[model samples]
Target: MIDLRIRTARPDEATRVLVFWKEAAEGTSVTDDVDGVTRLISRDPEALILAESDGLLVGSVIAGYDGWRCSLYRLAVLPSHRRRGVSRALLEAAERRFAAVGGRRGDAMVLEANEQAHGAWAAAGYRKENHWRRWVKPFAGPSRPV
Candidate 1:
């Protein structure tokens, strides 16, 4: 395995993260922009976890704990770094973050078409909740203020 360092992302690294996602992530997200990522970091600085090797970003995972649910998103590792324990390290870090915050359970948002991700998630001991299906409706404009 490569020499890995895991840490929470800084707000200033949003752009670099986005670029890394494009290369490493399997699918696109509606909130994959600078503003969205910046907002996420601004709101929960510890939610975004990053993995680096020799100062080069190799993986990331969003371990978002919203008081009730622990949601994992954007679990991605560079193709060059796959099977090198990058994803495993990222998930372990994410799970640690969730447990530290009193999260009861953790769930990941994965694409149906990404079969490769299935094995990775399973290897990390995350089973699919076959009974639960994700439902989403994107807003046409800016989100309403809370």
Candidate 2:
């Protein structure tokens, strides 16, 4: 039997949450560090939920609702937790929260090149917005003299 507990992230548990975030995103993201993730979670713990099993954190999904739009991101489920219904449960929980807060709709900006994530999101009912084209400028951060 798979034992799972889902709850809103606590301020102090952001570190552990980021650990699972990096693991699930192993080769797919550039900003996979804890520092940036910690900053985001701290700003809104209510939008972040964690799934734990056997005292080990395994899944997480963050929802951000800014009145007009709601976004779901940083969704991750450890390898061991995949296909055990963790991801689905976590996603459903996120949707509920979004709805409760009057979020008009939910959106996820999945990398088009990441087929795995695309497939999962598609199966979970996310449709491609055909009108959108993503643009990225890596390391487009504050310039500092080295």
Candidate 3:
């Protein structure tokens, strides 16, 4: 029996989810803050998935579909919860959401520097697109010095 309870994250849980992502997720994104998260929740309520065990958040994944594209992000699992199907559960929920919305494919943003995530993603049946490189342009906002 899978003990983890996977569900859509509630609006009020955005802060808590961000805190968890900081600890377990590979890296942060431009939308990792409270306002950005709130906007995400408001725009697509079911896009953010959370996995909990015994009242504690163990894993999370964002499955965002903007009519034309489906993107996954922030897939994370607590260190103690890794390898216990937490991430799998989150991904499953995300996939289901995408499928229901007629999404033909899903793309995930995994940092190339995070080697540990490579194996996990591969294990989940995701292949790396070697020819593709990400391009970004930061808008004027609270940008972090990296």
Candidate 4:
């Protein structure tokens, strides 16, 4: 419940964020490492949003816009900071940023196995698209086989 500061993360801080995610986030993405995250920041500086309380990292969300669709990823809050409006604040900031950039819809990438996140996303007015399925092909590095 402390005052939280939501801001964009610098590319140099990607390693710290990777460490934080390993601890706070439920699951990991193929690009969860320092180099990958650093690349993301380098490409789109505003996409990696961070939340800090008293200068300590507490929450994070990636709001990415590809000139059209808005996609949210890595919406994670520290275990101790859950239910403290940290995620909401991050999401609100991301939503505002998306709206400002002419994004009409926001899609979140969530793992189906992370049932705990289901309630949080639902409470924030997001629903799963049962009619659609994600198909991905990895050109480099680690990836889930399709």
* Candidate number of the best TM-score: 4
Give per-residue lDDT, candidate 1, residue 129.
85
Worst 10 residues of 2 by lDDT: 137-146
lDDT of 3 by residue, 1-146 (tens): 25999999888988999899988987777777888888899999998999999999999989999999999988899988888888878888998899999999889989889887788888898899999987876684666532
Error of 3 at 71 (Å): 0.5
Best candidate, lDDT = 1
Query: Which parts of model 4 have CA positions greater than 4 angstroms off?
Result: none
> lDDT value for candidate 2?
0.75
lDDT (tens digit, per residue) of candidate 1 on 5-116: 9999999999999999999998777788999899999999999999999999999999999899999999999999999999999999998998898999999998989999
Give the per-residue lDDT digits (tens) of candidate 4, residues 1-146.
67999999998898899999998997767787788899999999999999999999999999999998999999999999999999899999999999999999999988899898898899999999999888888766766742
Worst 10 residues of 3 by lDDT: 137-146
lDDT of 4 at 146: 27
Which scores better on TM-score, 1 or 4?
4
lDDT of 2 by residue, 1-146 (tens): 26889898776675676667667853434544566556666777678888889888888887877778889887788986677777788888989999899887898867666677776787788888999876665674444311
Model 3: pairs clashing at backbone N, Cα or C within 3 Å: none
As for candidate 1, its clashing pairs are none
Clashing pairs in 4: none
CA-lDDT, candidates in order: 0.92, 0.75, 0.87, 0.91
Residue 75, model 4, lDDT: 95
